[model samples]
Target: MIYKVFYQEAKDSTPRREQTRALYLDIDAQTELEGRIIARQLVEEHTAYNIEFIELLSENHLEYEKTHADFSITEF
Candidate 1:
């Protein structure tokens, strides 16, 4: 399954309306728990980010792909 993670830089406050979107990430994992874990690990290792939420995308993956021109599955 694919999980979409919305996050913001740890040093930054909540984004304003004009922010468009928080830094976006899509991770492929066997389950929701695994997806969350990997996302956290990647963020912790690469940059400081506060995860806003995680959404399961396997159901809406097609729509997501069409909507986000830069969509990709993040590697852990």
Candidate 2:
């Protein structure tokens, strides 16, 4: 499964640290259900922060990538 994670970094209201959060996941999976499960777990794991998730399915390879750019710059 190939997965791409898009996220953003921002300063939280508190002064301790910054936040890097997931916005979406592009995935290559054997089945739609598995992709959904992976996306759900990722969202669950980061629920405490301001993270969001989207899932897309492919069936070619098992690669995972992450990006931290603005959504407006990325072509949907």
RMSD per prediction, one decimal?
3.1, 9.3
Residues 1-76, candidate 2: write the lDDT tens digits: 4333433343254423244443545544678778767765665575544333444524332222333333321213
lDDT of 1 by residue, 18-74 (tens): 443333456767877887788778767887666667666665664766586566555
- For candidate 2, which ten residues in a row score worst on lDDT? 66-75
Model 2 misplaced stretches (Cα beyond 4 Å): 1-22, 49-76
lDDT of 2: 0.45
Q: How do all models score by TM-score? A: 0.59, 0.34
How big is the positional error of residue 33 in model 2, measured in Å on the Cα after superposition? Answer: 1.3
Q: After superposition, how far is residue 58 of candidate 2 from its true place, in Å?
A: 9.8
**Candidate 1 Cα outliers beyond 4 Å, as residue runs:** 20-30, 67-69
> Whole-model Cα lDDT per candidate?
0.64, 0.45
